[model samples]
Target: MLNAFHFQQPLWLTALVPLGLLAWWLKRHRHNDNAWQKIIDAPLQALLLTEASGKSQPALLWLLASGWLIATLALANPSWEYQPRPVFQTDTAQVIVLDLSRSMDITDLKPTRLARAKFKVEDILAQQKEGLMGLVVFAGDAFTVTPLTRDNDTLRALLDSLSTQIMPAQGSRADLGLLKAAELFKQAGLHQGQVLLIADGAERKTSVQAAKVLQKQGYTVSVLGVGTPIGGPIPNVRDAQNQPIVVPLQVSTLQQIAKAGGGIYRPLQSDDQDIQDLLTSGKTIQGKQARQSDDLQHQDWKSEGPILVLLLLPLAALAFRRGWLLTLGFVIIPLLQPDPLMASPLDKLWLRPDQQADQALREGNYEQAEQLAQDPLRKGSAAYKRGQFEQAVNEFSQLHNPDAHYNRGNALARLGQYEAAIKAYDEALKQQPDMSDALTNKAKVQALLDQQKQQKNQDNKNKDNNENKKQDGKNQENSSSSENQQKNDQQSGQKNTEPSKNADGQSGEAPQDKNSAADNHTSSSPKDQDSRQAEQKKPASDEKSNNGKEQKKDNQFANANQAMDKNKGQEQPDENEDAIKAPPQSSQPAPENTEPRGDPKRQQAIQEADTLNNEEKLAAEQWLNRIPDDPGGLMRRKFKYQYQQRRQPAGISNQTPW
Candidate 1:
C-alpha cells in the first residue's frame, strides 16, 4: 500500500498539460507546409527524405532532465497514501549453528565439512528474511560466533573466520554447542524461531540436551547434518617445507548433535548446488514472492546520481560518433585516486637491518655491524652475533621481521630478557603471522617468565616469614625477661622476711626491726640483689648453685654426727661412769653471784631446765615447784641413808665408799 503514493514535479504536469492542449489545437487548424523547393525539384525533396539523420543532443538532454526529475521526486520523501503493513510475516528468529571442529577439515565432502556448512549458511541467509540470525560454532568447545542479528553480511563474515584449526583441542562438542545455542535463543527472545544446526554429530549429549531445553523454551530446531554416516578421518594439517600437510579426517560428531538438538539431519552434500537445494526445500524456506513490507527506505541518490552520470559517459561515447562531449566529460571529471599511504610500504618490503647485519657479520666487521644494527631501521643479525642482545632488541623494534625478531629473541634470551623477548616475538608474529618458530619461542619465554615470577614470589614469602620469625623470637625473649625480673623481685622481698622455722624445735634469729633489717640486709648482702638478678638472668645456672648448696649442707650434718660418736668412744670407762653418776650442773655459769652451785636441788632443777628447749623449760619449772624444800637435816639424813642403802644391797644404791 505504501508503494502507491509518490511525490511528482508540478512543473512537469503543468507543462505537459499545455503541450497536450497545443498539440490538439494545432492538429485541428494547421496545414502542411509546401516549400517552393518542392515545385522546383521533386527529386531534391526525395533526396532530403532519403538522407539518414543522426540523433540530436536535445533528446539526450531531455532524457537526462527527466531522469533528474524522477530522482528529485524520490528524494522528496515519497510514501504510499495507504495503510501501514508489517515488515515480517512471522516473528520467528533463526540461528545457524555451525560445526568448527577439526573434523570439519575432512575433505570427504569436496573442500571440507566447514566449507560445505558455510555454503549452506549463505543459502539459508539468501532464503530467509526478517527476525534475527545467530551463528554458533562447536568444536572441543562451542561458543556463539555471532548472536542473532538482522545483518547478513556480518554473520557471513563471522562464518568465514571460523575453521577447525581455531580450536587446537579438537573434539566435537555438540552438547556444549547446543546448550550454548539454547542460551542464545533464550537471550534472543525468539519464541518460535528455528535453530538450524549444521554439524556432523560426533557427540549427541550436548545437542540432545540443547534440543530439549530449546523445546521447553518454545524454540524449534532444524539440523543440517554436515558429515557422512561412514565418517571421514579428520585431517591434520601442517607445514612440511611449503607442502600441504594432509591428515585423515576423524568421525563426524555433529550428526547426533543435530538429531538430538531437535533438528532434521540433512547430510552435507559437497556440491554447492546440492546444498542449496537442501536448504531451500524445508518448510522454513520463504520464497522470492514472500510479501515483505519494509519501510520506504530512501537511499542517498545524490552521490549515486553523479556516479551514474559518470558511468553513462562511456555508454554515451559508444552510442555517439565523434562524441567529443562525452570525451570531454571523462577528461574534465576528476577520478578518485587510490590512497597510496593507506597501505604501508613496510608491508610489502622487508627492510631487514638484521639481514644487512648478517652480511656485515659474514664480512667479519662485527662491531661496526653491531653498532649499525642498533639503529631502529636496521635488522638484529649483527647485534645477535656480537652478543649485544639489548642492541638487537632496539634494532628490531622497528623492523618487526619474524626471523629478525626470532634472532633478537634469541639474543634477549641469552641475556635473560625473557619478557622483552616475548614482546619482540609477538611483534614479529604480527608481521609474519603463524610462524611456528616465533610461537614456540614465545611459549618458552612465557614459561620462563612464569618460573621466574613464581621463584620471586617464593623468595619474597620466605623473606617475610624469616623476618616474622625473628620478630617473634625477640618478642618471646622480652616477655621471658620481664617474667624473670618479676620473679626476682618477689624472691628479694621474701628473703627480707625472718628466716622460716623448721620442725627441728629451733627458731631463727630475730629479724631486725624493719628499718635496721632493710639496711643491714642490704649492707650485709649487697650481692643479694645482684645474685637474685643474676639467678633470674640465668635460671639454669642458679638451679645448679641451689643443688650444690643443698649437697654441702647434707655433708656438714653427716660430719657433725660422726664427730659426736668419736668423742663418746674416746672417753675412759671410769670417767664415763663418774660423769654419769655426778649431779648435773648448768652448762653456762649463772649470772655473777646471783646463784651458787651448793644448792643441789636448785642446781638439779636448773640442769634439767637447761636441757629443755624453750617450750620444755616451762614444764620443768612447774615440776620443780611441786617438790618440797627438804624433809630432814640435810647432812645426817644424807649420811645414814647412804650407809644403809649401800649395806642393804650391792646393786640397790651406789652409796658404798671406795
Candidate 2:
C-alpha cells in the first residue's frame, strides 16, 4: 500500500517542507536574541529574568511549525491502494461492435434479432472480469457509443436505448464499425484487443477487407451471429404481392469475414459455451504474451487526501494556545462558514426558471412553456407541441439548423401546406443530406399532394358528366315538342284539302250534266257533237296537270319528315337547312277555272313551322351562351360559328316552288 502511495499535488509538499524547517530555526534564533538582550540590560534583565519570565514554556513554536507541516501534507492530496475485496483481473480489453441496421429488426430469433443480441451483450458484460469494455453501434456509418470503460451499467443503459430507427442511415457497414472499435482500443493504449461483433451478418465487400486490416493490427475479431441461418421477414415492409419480404442471415459472409480476420465465428445459442469460448480465447492470447505488466491489472485505488486533512485536526489542536474564546471562535467560525467549492444541498434541489420551463414542456403545458422559453429553438418546439403550427413556423424560421428546418417541415405539413413543407425539407436535406426522417416525410407529403390533385381531376370529370346529362334531357324535350307541332300541321292540311276535293267532285257532276244536255240538243246537228268532243279533251289535260302538282307536294312533305327524323337525335339542330328546305307560302289566290289550291291551309302550316324553327334556334343560342370558354379558344369559336349559321337560316323560307 505504501509503494502505491502517490501525491496529487507534490509541489505543495516540496515547497512547504523547507518553510517548516525555516520556521523552527527562526523560533530558536528569537530565543537566543532574548537571552543576549537580557545580559546587555542588567537592571531590566533582573526584572525580565524573574521566576514568571524565566519559567520554562511548552514548545509552542515547535507545535506551530508541526501544524504547518501537517496542513501542507493535507494539501498534497495523497492517495494509495486499499483493497476492500478481491477482484478478477485479466490482460485483455474488448470492444463489442453492435449492428443497428434495419435487418437487425428481423425476428429470426426470439423477440427479435436485435433484442437477443442485446441480451447476449448483457451476459458478456456480466462475465467480463478485469478487461475494459467499449461499445460501438453502426448502421450505414459507425460511431463509438462508449469508449473503453470498466463501468458495465453505463454500457448497458446505452445499449438498451439503441434501435435501428435511432440510426440516421440504414445499411450494414461492418467495416466502419470495426474501424471505430480499433480506434477506441488504440486510444486506450492497447496494442492488441478483442473485438466481439454482434450482428445479423449482413456485410458489404468492404467488411472483409477491413477485418483483414484489423487482424493485421493484432485485433482478434470474433463474430457472434445474432440471427439464425433460416431467417424471417422484416416487419413494416412488404413486397409487390403485399406480403412481408423475407431477409435471411448471411452465414457465408460472416464465415468469410471471420476467416479474413483470423478469428472464430459461431451462432448465438441458448448455452453459454460460445461466450465461454470467447473468454478462453482471450486468456489464451494473454498467456502467449512474453510478460504481463501490473498496468494490465487495472487496480482500483482510494484517495488518502481526506485522511490527511483529518490528521491536521489533531495537529491544529496541539498548536492552539489554551484559551476558551479562541477555541470556541475557531470551532464555531469554520462550522458556520459555507463551503465555497460546492453549492448547498437545498440550493441544488431547488428548480431554476429554465428548469421549471423544461419541466412544464415535459408535462405538456406547451403554451406556458413557450412563454417561458428564452431560446428560439425551445420556443419553436413548445409552439409545435401546442399545435400552433403557424407560430412554430415563424419561430423556427429564425433558426438555421437541420433539426429546426426538419421540425418546421413537420409543422407546415400539419397545416396542410405540403408544397411549403417540401421546401422546408429540402432545406433540411441541404444541411444534412442523409437525414432519413426528413426524406421519409418529404416523400409522404409528395404523395399527399398527388392524391389531392387526383381528387380534383375526378371532381371536374363528374361535373362535366352532369352537364352533358342535363343537355341531353333538354334536347329530348325539344324534339318531342317539334314532333307534336308537325303532327298538328299535317292534320290541319288534310282538313283543308277535304273541302277542295268535294268541290271538284261537284264541278265534275255539273260538267257531266252539261255534256248530256249538249248531246241531246246536238243529236239533230253533227257540228254540235264535234264541238262537245273538243271540250271534253280540254278538261282531261287540266286534270292531269293538277295530279302532277299534288304528287310533287306529297313528295316534298315526305322529304321534310325524313329531315326532321334525321335531326331528332342531334342536340343542336341545323336551322339553316330547315329554312332552305321550307317552301315559301303563295299570297296570290288561284283563278276559279284553274284547279283550286289549298293556299290558306298551306300558309298556316308554313307559318307554324317557321315559328318552331325560330324557337329552336333561340334555344340553341342560349345553350351556346351557357358553355364556358375553352383554354385554347377553339371550342368557343366553333360554338359561335354554329350559332351564327343557325340564326342566318332562321330567316330563310321552309317552302320552295315545285
Candidate 3:
C-alpha cells in the first residue's frame, strides 16, 4: 500500500505554493489591523499601537494556512490501491451469429464449412477471458441458441447440436442473424456489443442494411467468411440433373458490411488469428474511445478525492463560530450566477412576437407558433398543422392570397363542407391559374359533392324499395290471415252445432258435453301427446318457409350491395335506421299446409344426417390427436412466425439460396 501511494491529480498539489503565500500575506497585513488603523486618529495611534510578543499569536492566519494545506492535499486525489475495470466494453459483450444454411453443408473446409465454423467459435470461447458470449443461428430466420452468458460449456454443447436440418427453412439470411445478435445484446442489457457473423455468404443488400442498423445502435458487425474464394458445390443440393450448386465466399461484399458496421472482416483461418482480430474490433470501431483506455463511461479517473473531504470537517465546524457559512455562500453564489450580458443563440429575449413565432415554426412548435404569429396566413398555417381546422379556416378567411385560399379550402374540406371547400379552391385557381394543387383539390372536392349526392339518391331508392317490400308483405299477410280466420270460424260453427244438438236432445247431454270439453282441454295442453306432435310439426314447417324467404331477402341485399360503394360520410342522415330496418316477422305471409314446408320423415332424416356429421368430425379430431408431436415443432412454428413478421419490403435475394 505504501509503494502504491501516488497522486491521481498531481496538478492540484501546485495550489499549495500559492496557498502558503496567501497565508503569509494575511499574517503580515491582516484586515482587522488595517481597519483599526483607518478608524484611529493620529494622536490615538500611539495609544492604540499595542504589540503582543507572541502572547495570543495570529491564530486565524495559522488556521487558514492549515486548512488550505489539507484542502490542496485532498484535491491532489491521493490513491494507493488498484481497482479492476474493463479496457473496452467491446470484449465484454459479444454475440456469435452462425449460419446454418444448406450451403454450410458444403465440404469446403476439412469436414464442412459449418463444422469448421463451430470449431472457430469454440476457439473464440476458449480464448475469451472476461465477457458474456451468446450463440445465434440463422438460415431462413434467426433464433437465439443462447442469450449472452459466460457458460462456455453450455454454448459449445448447443453449438454442436445445430445443423441445417434443424432450421425451419434454408437460406443465408445473415440480416436476421445480425438482428438476432442485436436482440441478444438488448436482452442482456448491454448498451453496446460486437456481433461476429460466421457464414459462407449472405443476402448482400439486406445484410449491409442490418449491419448499418446495428452500427447506429453502437454494435459492430464483424464477419468471418467460412468458405474459400475458390468455392465448392453444396452437398445433397443439385439442380434438375446431377449438377452441384456452387456457393462461393462473398469476400468483397462482407468487407463492405464490416465497413458499414464500423468493424473488421476476416476470412476463416487455420489459426485463432481471425477470432483474435474480431475480439479487438472495438479498438478500431470506437477509435478515440478505445484510445483513452482509462476512461470508463465518460469518467477518466475514479478519484478518491471526495472521500478525503472528511478532513475539512474541523475547519467547517470552526467556520460557523465566525458566521463564515453565510459569508462564503454570499461570495460564491454571485460568481455562480449566470452572466447577464452573454446570451445563448436560442435566446428570444430581444425577438419580436412574429420573429419568435417564425423561430417556433422552424423548430416545429406549431402551437407556440400559432399563439405568437402576428400574420393571419402564418397563424392559419400553424393552426392547420395543429389540427385546429375551424380556427385555421377562420384565420385563412381573413387573408385573400392564393396560398391562403388554398389553405382555407384544406381546412374547409377537413370540416366536411365540400361545397364551400370547392368554392375556396376555385378562388385559389382564379388567383393563380396554374396552381395545380388547388385545381386538383377543386376537382376532388367536386367529385366528393357528386358522390355525396349520388349516395343520398341511392339511400332514398333503397329506402323506397324496403318500404314497398314491407307494404306488400303486410297486404299478403293480412289477406292470408283474414281468409284463415273465416275458414276457422266456419269450422268452429260446424263443430258447435253438432255438440249443441246432442246436448238439447238428451237430458244426459250436459254430462256428455262436459266430458267432451274436458277431453278437448286435455288435448290442447302442451304436455299432452297430440299437442306435442302438433307443435313439433309446426316449427319445422315454419323454419323451412323462413329459410326460403331469407334466401330471397339475401339475394336482394346482395344486389344492392354491389352498387352501394359510395361512403356514407357526414352528409348522410343519421335517422335512417328505422327506414332501413330488416323486414318484420309479423308482415310475412303464413305458410300453406298444402305445400311441403316440412315433412316429419324429412325432418327426422335431416336430424339423423346432422348427428352422423358431428360423429365423423369427432372421430377425425380424435385420430388427429393420436399422432405424436414433433420434437422440432416449437422451433418450426417460431421460425415461421418470425419469417412472416420480418419479410423486408425490398424483396429478398434470389441469386443463391446460400
TM for every model, in the order presented, reads 0.33, 0.34, 0.35
Full candidate order by TM-score, most accurate first:
3, 2, 1
lDDT of 2 at 282: 67
Candidate 1 lDDT over 47-89, as tens digits, reads 6553233235445544444444444443443444434443445
Mark the regions of model 1 whose C-alpha exceeds 4 Å error after superposition.
Answer: 1-6, 9-88, 229-233, 237-259, 270-658
**Per-residue lDDT tens digits of candidate 3, residues 307-329?**
77897888888876767757888
What's the lDDT of the predicted structure labeled candidate 1?
0.55
For model 1, the run of ten residues with the poorest summed lDDT: 583-592
lDDT of each: 0.55, 0.68, 0.72
For residues 521-628, what per-residue lDDT tens digits would candidate 2 score against the true structure? 443345634654455445445444444454355456667656755765454244434334322211111112433367787778667757767767676554444344
TM-score of candidate 1 against the unseen true structure: 0.33
Q: Count the backbone clashes (under 3 Å) in each candidate.
A: 27, 6, 0
lDDT value, candidate 3, whole model: 0.72
Off by over 4 Å in 2: 1-91, 240-243, 288-291, 295-658
